[model samples]
Target: MTSFAELVRYLAERFLQAGIESAALDARLLAAYAAGFSPEETVTKRDAALPPEVLDRAVEAARRRFAGEPVSRIVGAREFWGMPFGLSADTLDPRPDTEVLVEATLAWCRKHDLAGAPLRILDLGTGTGCILAGLLSELPNASGVGVDRSEGALRTARQNFARIGLDSRAFFLCGDWGDALADATFDIITCNPPYIETGDIAGLCPEVRDFDPLLALDGGKDGLKAYRDIVPQASRLLRVSGLLIFETGHRQARLVRDMLTELDAGFQTEIFPDLAGIERAVAGVRQSGGDGGRGKKKVGNPIGSG
Candidate 1:
């Protein structure tokens, strides 16, 4: 191609023919990634001819994309909470909907005037460590430990935190849920666990079904396995009045809330919608104990009616 625009359009047409819905945007992003340039730079230089090496890179990326590999997988990164996170074969790519968990936690902290205090945070099923890293970026005084069952996921998570200069404030551990946490309690605990049921896994989109790790997607028979595995531990892992924020699968908010409530009577739950008006997240506050009654505060939903 003689120009970046031409390259992008060519790639877009290929992707379109391949039945990719976000063809144009994906093409542009892939071209920029392959060319070792920012998407903005690619846009600005759209009319310029690509270097032979860059064209080769773009061609290879297109081939992979055509083969059903996600652009994030081909590019080895995905942006979450406006920051780049490295990806691993075993880690779930960060999804925009998961950001609801971060937003909710931040709002909870702000409402309780806990944002400025030295706080410990925990992230179960950390995946790309997106939730923990995103929270640390906003809560300056917060230090977090991200626990994942996959060592590969942990490695990529560490890379992401270090890439964004949050490594000093972030710790990664390999374990299933809160098993590694012991008696340690935190000001906020977050998770975006695998909530897609095993039977439903086959129906996921190509990117999720083929590119995302099964370990990060399969939630058991009813998609409630992770909830069952996490709720009881989370109840113990949170300090009295601490917050537990997590993302759930479609239509999972209410059931997940019930699971938490049944697991611990101390927690008071609130469900919030994502930007798309879907109830995608639930946050529970540990009530009772020394200064642990924030659940009784009238802090309304932080992410109000979407």
Candidate 2:
């Protein structure tokens, strides 16, 4: 029988040889998952013997990791906005960069005195329902609708909302953009749509290129298709003074802002930076009925060129 330590060492070496960036961590995670123990517990109990079935499962998981599957997908979950969310091939994995959109939205809500109200929110392309779930958790009085084009992705979002105990406060719908909510309007709208140019998908890392849904990555020829669709619809879906926020590729910030301007001449727009100091989020607010000058001047870029 292969010992627990021996299996871990073997898998770690294999993952390293396969060019996995975090080989040892992947091996440890697989081992801990198979053994039904936390990662720290696995390390503390490294001398423990492994059951044959457990070892087999660990080995198989390690092989999948070595084959370039994301560790989040391998583990079937990921952390976003300080919460755990389930994952599926049906949706794009929630990324840390998307937290920028949440942060900007939250700041806007606070500034507008809407943070504690029973605000209505709409999340487009709500993969894994991370943004909606996190927002609902933070703003107890807020309720949201999460929309995705894929039925499978909506199913996963529904399951995740239930898992996170937010089902009662949130609704999941299957439709493109805001179509499912034809007669509804919201105080806030958020999205992290596909922002990669079609041609660039081939150049992404294997974990993304091979495993992630293409529908979640390709953003048309210049990586702005979703922005074009989202901006115009947001104009119709938002109430007066409603806020629309979304994540975008770092290089596409200027173009996205321009698209929003052309979509709605009255939108007041700004950009927010990610942790890496790159401009990664674009936000716009509907102007109140008046001679609406653009609400705010462009702030200095917050995200670094990462």
Go through the candidates in order and give each one's C-alpha lDDT.
0.84, 0.82
Off by over 4 Å in 2: 1-7, 289-306
TM-score of each: 0.92, 0.90
Candidate closest to the true structure, highest TM-score: 1
Question: Who wins the lDDT comparison?
Answer: 1
Candidate 2 residue pairs in backbone clash: 277-303, 277-304, 278-303, 278-304
Model 2 C-alpha lDDT per residue in residues 1-306, reported as the tens digit of each score: 666677778878888888777888787777777878875777688888888999878877877886778888988988898778888998888888888888778777776677799999999999899999888888989999999998889888999989888999988888889877778999899999999999999999988999899999999998999988888787679998788888889598878777665554356678887889998988877765443334544433222121
Error of 1 at 269 (Å): 0.9
Cα deviation of 286, candidate 1, in Å: 0.6
**Per-residue alpha-carbon lDDT of candidate 1 for residues 122-200, written as tens digits (9 for 90 to 100):** 9988888888988999989989999999998988888888889999998889998998878788888888888898999
Give the Å error, residue 168, model 2. 0.5
Candidate 2's C-alpha lDDT?
Answer: 0.82
Q: What CA RMSD would you report for each candidate?
A: 3.0, 3.3
